[model samples]
Target: MNTTQLDYTDITEIRGPLMVVRGVDGVGWDEFCRIDTGDGQLRHGLVLEVDGDLAVIQVLEGTTDVVAEKVAIRFDGAPLRIPVGDGWLGRVCNGRGEPLDGGPPVYGREMSSVAGWPLNPVLREPPSQPVLTGVSVIDGLTTLVRGQKLPIFSVAGLPHLELATQIAAQATAGGEPFSVVFAGMGLTHADAAFVRDALDDRSAAGELALLINTAGDPVIERILTPRLALTIAEHLAFTQGRHVLVVAADMTSYCEAVREVSAARGEVPARHAYPGYLYSDLAGLYERCGRIRGRPGSVTILPLLTMPAGDITHPVPDLTGYITEGQIVLSPQVHARGVYPPVDPLSSLSRLMRRGAGPGRTRDDHLDVAAQLLGALARARQARELAELIGAGALGPVDQAYLHFEDRFGRDFVSQRPTEAHTLDQTLERAWQTLSSLPRRELTMIPDRLLDAYYRSDHG
Candidate 1:
């Protein structure tokens, strides 16, 4: 359909970011459109739907001054496309991919659809390589793997943003050519500034790219933030053969934008007024990460979303948990205690931890040590509950030891300085030091050989 030759003046209704045109022909869904206001202003849009002679368009920029009688629409007959290339590295841009660093425009080597294709399951190589995040809790516990989609489930006021930035500054792809694409959705101006400052070193080093959408930006632009990021990442990982790590912060805001648009469209709402297709919509973004067989690079995702009112059952986090491989749950309780990451090991998991850790990948004893540490932490939690009811005086000797072990674990292992990046060996050594406080009899999860090699019985 050559929509350029056909202009429509039949905008029958203008409803909150949406405009409906009547007597339209050969219009297709998702085709780009340009809305020309009578007073020399233009707005870009996408055809949301087309039925018979009626077409619905979602205005990319909000419809602030659009008059139904004087508006004209021209369809481009194509979905939204973004120019992508290697030149995007070490650059900063807004959610829509416009330069925010006062730099020149990105001269793209190629242009690609923001709506990426799903990887065939048969072509996906099982994610196995460890992506060392330099955080002891993550590297030693919930190991992030190459091509894995792992999310950080957080609450308001927690330092998930700080943690995400720290990971971006320190994570590695086993000495491979690694890159990071950070997408900040609906962030405040101060938060956006914080991200730029925190990642300045990485950006200066040409290892990071930032895409930020502030709270004041249009809601529709927030919806496109992650898509633009993933499109660029796909180009980097597949075409350029660079292992790319995409960090998307506050996806809850993105979901809310989705819900807002859904409301404007008058679509039937599902859970919590979110559209029924919320699951598939989120999957479309997360499922884009993986290593294709015979390809030299992979795309690993770490999407951070805050659960509204600390409710995990909220549609956003709930659906995300189902799609991603696992989650790193940040604990308000631990955060209140002043832990840097506040990662609740009991609540957090990495499904690919086993495949990424152990032997040659990280350490031979990583799997065993992590299991023992978690088991000990569980006992410590139980002992703390008992002490709360019966007082520490009534606790048994083993219970007392477990309490001390827990204190050491949180202070030494779980808590780290924001800039302190630990290697796999340093992390493992700290794990062993924390576990050495427990009695040898309680260390059943660790093999005897490992105990003799790394564990110190005298410290127990």
Candidate 2:
């Protein structure tokens, strides 16, 4: 905790966004810096590494016309911090936490570190409450639980961004105090507009906070977007007692930025030229979520990243799967079939769904119905593959029944309009309708008593 601000004029080298300062004394890691470009222009930067008397500084605004001898660099001797409170709701900000919505600057009484404070593992409470995203496929099957970290895995050209925005706008905490903090990294201008327009109502209602770093913005800012979003979310949830959901989209961009910065630093690369600490770095962000024991509110994270070349084994998605609780996989095949969500049930999973759904939380039949639907969908997949090899006429009656069930399920249950929002009860009813097409004998996963109550023989 050095409090002295050091000013220096001797810069050793400049490359891309990184600049090396020589003859520096007592500079700390992550300390904020100010660069005066001699031409009366000022830019902000951060200390990335401090070695002996030399320090590596990353210019947040990039370095295009910086003159080493003429530039004046000042180390602030502290990490970056932002104002946090209720004032952030309904406001749009850039990656640096500056206002982008043309509103007044946030002048709250409290400030929090952008790097985030650490939570004790002993104090972490397991997630048990449900966070309902109004889409039937998610709410009825892989239910999102409070304080959970779930990633949405999608390939290029899939509408994962649209799905992320829809959930941010429509998710609810069962009439409890709730809010959503959305962070979009490396988004195009059009994509940023789509996110803002989709969440306009929520913003007006003071239940949303948007932080966007566009593709044209500084590449260094992309690394800060998620941290800024989570800092505000921690303030709103733990301090203000409101359940906060943090949605970070296009994390692939964020990782690329990391790889770029790593390359700039002359660091040795691991897989795909990403740093060796990729997993730990991702954990630093995703682990910021969940409920702390004795804390009134919770922070849940939903991150969306595109799998490069449709390869799930890519370093980004593969490492993400290891860190997050579960994933919601979007399918190109399903998307081509004209489904709005295109969620592949067999591919998606929620590890904490059981804790959030069931008799007391969502519905008594929720777990049972989800199980039955998955079983039927798996059989249907097998039946479709079999029919593809041998003509449809060669399939038996049971296989034909599965084929019909798959069609009805995709048409009736998995598909929903982007603007439409469904309640848990409505989602359950839709689940039943899709399941009804199957014979009563196929539903061995559900209890007989519960089946008699909700199953309609005529619906098939």
Candidate 3:
């Protein structure tokens, strides 16, 4: 392999955010490069493609005011690598890992590739531990598990960002050494500020590392932010032995960037005009989480993406549901009711919750209570529909009781302040309180032992 720096001045075609170099020798793909323009300004670039004697370069800061003949490009003979270690905590960096908080550039003794090292499938342990997100709708029903990739599926105009940031600011792993790596892609200025303000105390306490790529920034940076953030998280979780949760928001922007670049390169498009390798590309990021055998630490991921026009069958969410464990779906109808989290219980699910929330992990009665609550909610929905068809005054007592249960469940179990964080026990208590609105005989999913011990008829 060539390890020597090579400089080229061959004149070639220039395109949007891309430069084609002629007469290049031994230039490798993804290799870093420095671009010096005639006006004495230096820009960063990445090697996108290489044939025998020609290479395509992607300008990181874009190709404005860059003259093809006046620019000299130098290959650094290596792929993109960044300083990685404990020094990243409490720091805010841009997509390229450059400091944005007025602090000096983050440095450490070791540098790691942004493209992470793959984990061996044989060495992975099944996820069996709970990650408390402090939201009753999630913790009580769709419990997030360690070493899982559970995405939040939302549509535009919903408060998915608020729910994601709140979870990142408050999630914990039962008194263990925990940290959060939050990456925001193509965020507006106000959205970025909200993230900083929400996690300010956590950052100050050395528990957070934030990376932002704003709407005004280069689109190429949006493609790099999650990879860089995950590289940092893998360092903290695997090398240093700490539980790390990665929260990446607005992945829709990231996919758009991928589609934009694909169009630039003239690659054949797949569903929804995205690159054909979209599933593989997303797997490369989401599959980076999990626990390795004999290792005490874990990396859990909760990525948030908006569904275009609320279409669940869209390629993004559809492919994500195939790659991830399950999804936590946010609803506009529930948000209209003024619920803080607005998670639709009928739509949201955590496929690994059974393995993560049963006896010895969260509580012995956790599964039973979850079953009863969900069953009651399903019945409540039917009763409400029935009431709409037939006048409420004509309903039977049992249906009326179900309608009452629904109101209590939505208010007591689903609604909470944005800043509120509930413990697992508190969440279960609220579940029991909501169930008490139904008759004792109606709660048949819960075991007799737990019903006798925890059931209270006062709410009924």
Measured by lDDT, the strongest candidate is 2
CA lDDT scores, all candidates in order: 0.92, 0.92, 0.90
How does candidate 3 score on lDDT? 0.90
- The residue-by-residue lDDT of candidate 2 on 358-434, one tens digit each, is 99999999999999999999999999999999989999988998999999899999899887899999999999999
Tens digits of per-residue lDDT, candidate 1, 353-390, equal: 99899998988899999999999999999999999999
Judge candidate 2 against the unseen true structure and give its global Cα lDDT, from 0 to 1. Answer: 0.92
RMSD of 2: 1.1
Off by over 4 Å in 3: none
TM-score, one value per model: 0.97, 0.98, 0.98
Poorest 10 consecutive residues of model 2 by lDDT?
1-10
Output the lDDT of residue 285, model 2.
Answer: 93
Q: Tell me, what's the RMSD of every candidate? A: 1.3, 1.1, 1.2
**Which of candidates 1 and 2 is the stronger one according to TM-score?**
2
Worst 10 residues of 1 by lDDT: 1-10
**Candidate 2 error regions (>4 Å):** none
